[model samples]
Target: MDSDELREVLQEAGLSPYQSKAYVALLELGTASARELVEASDVPDPRIYDVVRSLEDRGYVETYEQDTMRARAHSPADVLDDLQNRASRFEQAADEIEDRWEQPELDRHAASIVKRFETVVDRARLFIQEAENQIQLSASIEQYEQLRGVLADALDRGVYIQLSIYTNPDDDVELPAEEQLAATTTEARHRPIPSPFVALIDRQKACFGPHEDALNEYGVLVDDRMHEYIFHWYYSSCLWEICDEIYSSRNDEPPIEYVDVREFIRDVEPMLLDDLSVGVRVVGKDVSTGEERELEGEVADVFYEGDDYRGTREIPLAQLAGRASVTVATDEGEFTVGGEGAMLEDVEAMRLTITSASE
Candidate 1:
């Protein structure tokens, strides 16, 4: 590759422009002083030292105490290997932190509508991979038809697929001739959704769509890590404790119910007191504070009012008290929600208070 292409590749590999150029220059020149690097690489004289120091720290360059101070670049293969290793470590750390912190935020709005088909497909794909024991789907006629491919793929991969469709007077539940002849196939049992409908994948992920004209509108998919963790435990518990409630009866009941908690809360808000009850949990920390204080009792009670509703809620210290920022668990994944003035009382109320009075 030419210099520009090489520079771009280095940048994509996580090297700064100056560092890439200086390293490349060192590579070409073998061993060189900062002054030689600046001349060879066209890096400004003032910034060469900083770039060299950064490159040295990043393992792309090494410093030597010769007659005069000198720096030498590591081989290209060695540098690229170092960069790849660093990238892998960073990604692993991010994934771990996200799983620990971001899942709770997603659960708070688990029933929110999903409008984008692409998002639905992406979430559904994730749900399929996460499913372990069972998949129960209650889909609109159009959505059910559209997802035939996905369902067939899952079945082919050995996933148990159970499907239910809205009973249409004019349509049949069995696969059409063309669909049956297609490359995809599903070992699925079919039924009708009693009310609207819901899709549950191993109870780890759930989706809800409207009863009327659901295919025309959007829906939501809930596969948040925290919710998944909770559901996994719920699914694995002793049958004596909650078996009947947790396990569905294939003979009579719909495999999954479409329960929109937000709608339920909205319809029940009038009965609840003006004060809203909110609970916040600290899930993970991001910033390094040498203090070893436990996050327990870091939450505070606050009140707020709005034209629609007024309520009281507790905001976690991670949200209210700003010392070091931390990640919290949410239904979606790990995210930075609170900390450094992020927890506004009014905002929290607006978020949690369901206005049943308005319908």
Candidate 2:
């Protein structure tokens, strides 16, 4: 290599610029006095002695007295060997430091803000994988596509999922057939408004906030169940059902089924205890004809069955000219309600629907 390239290599291997130049000059000159080095290597006259001494100390050069001291560059192999030893020490120290480092657990309830999009996606993946029973998620179509693989894995693990896709309200967004087909097992829908991004797990934890952008893009993670429930309800009552359900001629069935009145009552007891009303739509199956029907209502009463809470809800029936009350048992699972043998238990799937804010 040329002198300039060799100097750069030596400096990269840990030598100072003056040391590199002096060493390279000595290699070419065979042996050189300090004055010769300054002329040949362009090292400043005042710093040449210190540079040569440093090179000698690093084992890159040897000095001998010849009236005045003269320096000789060590064999190229020897100088490189010394540098290699230094590189090895650096690697060892790095490994030791890494081993001693302890990363603290991230506080989910804390308001952590990540500005990078990649970090936001990575955190979202952790939230999905950490979910036990359910995952409630809302994102723009682009964001959803980015996380589809992680979400598919969550579903494979039997975690029930509710996904909502957000898009422009004024434009017709064509749904990708394969993407829609892949989510048949989960409750997936679309909304026209630009909804906030959200991911809630079992109503126990959540990460939610605005989309990624050049501005202050961030998310708030809540581990406190009570705080997460606010997000849960918002996801269920707003983002999840804010727009018309996406339908396709090729799609086989609806992504969601109504909860039986019995299951609905049991699932919503927490809200009742908090003196909050939860609106649920119950889809009943006709046993004889295999026909399906629905009833929308609110919880009206609560009772205890051993350790679990059971409750009742009243649904107004136009045929009966009055409201019909249905008893819901957590342990019993399903039952029948009203006059026309409209079966309430074990019909299909159950889901929460959007309700009026006042209700």
Candidate 3:
């Protein structure tokens, strides 16, 4: 690089303009008297001595009497070593200062803004890895691809994930199949609209922003539990409610285990002991003619046979005809309608699909 450019680099490394100019001049001239430096560099004659003195103190130059007073610039390697040593010391001090710093308390609703897209990506990774119990997020396929590694690690740690994601209908991006089968992924839904980059972790923290490439891209991180709850509510009530659950696997097989509510009552009953509702698909079979039939109507019930779990689910109305009994587990995704009925099942294979009973 030219002397002018090298001088600019030196200035960037914390040298004063006068010092950088004088050093570059000396390096170029090999050795220079006071007048020679003033002529070769932008440093004024009156300030040349002071600049050279400062350079000598910083170990970037050496001054000595050789007929006339002279200053010789240190080799570039030596100068850079000096700059690096100072930088290291500054970093060490900074680490010590941060160790002794106390974080100020902020309002629960307060959010801190990050102005860089790179920083936003970094903060998202931090939140995903720090999550303990659950992570709820909405993203475009591109956004999730950027975060796939950190998210996979979170899943490996047993964090439950509820994702509302969509592929860019116009783009060629495809969702990875392995991610669809992750054990920690409790539910994966397809959102039609584009999703702002956002995530809530453990109901304790949230980060949100526009797409990464948007003009003046920025993000905000809210650390309040109350704010976290609000983000989660918005995700569930607004985004999640409208998304379609991914019911079929890559091989077209249903990922959820479907069992006859009556035949598997002993095994299924214990699974439903929790207060949370379970999804089930109901089917009807004939006892006499060995014919199987399905119907549609609004009728549902949960009963126990001396603690043995027994449930009857009817398909949605449109085909109400048979005695509906066996309930197959289904999800509350867009594909499933909520009600007690048998009319809907008759339209298909007399099959009622439900959310995974194991979740």
**Candidate that scores best on TM-score:** 2
lDDT of 3 by residue, 228-311 (tens): 756765776666756788632222233233222222233334455543344454443433332554433221333332321123
lDDT of each: 0.45, 0.57, 0.56
- Cα error, candidate 2, residue 179 (Å): 5.8
Q: Model 1 has how many clashing residue pairs?
A: 22
**What root-mean-square deviation over C-alphas does model 1 reach?**
19.3
If scored against the real structure, what TM-score would every candidate get?
0.29, 0.44, 0.43
Runs off by more than 4 Å, candidate 3: 1-109, 179-184, 212-216, 247-359
**lDDT winner:** 2
If ranked by TM-score, best first, what sequence of candidates would result? Answer: 2, 3, 1
Clashes of 2: 3
Candidate 2 residue spans exceeding 4 A from truth = 1-104, 170-172, 178-181, 212-215, 247-359
lDDT of 3 at 301: 37
- Tens-place lDDT per residue, model 1, 198-255, is 5567544766545554556555556553443343333223111121221222222212
User: 1-359, model 2: which lDDT tens digit per residue?
Assistant: 45676667667777889887887677667566788889999999999999988887776665655467766554344454444566554344333222222122344453444333344455577778776567778887787877887787887886667678777777577764655535532666778777788887755567776754326664565666667756765776678645566542222322223322333334345456567654445544444565665545554453332431123333211212222234322233433343222333333323333242122
Clashes of each: 22, 3, 32
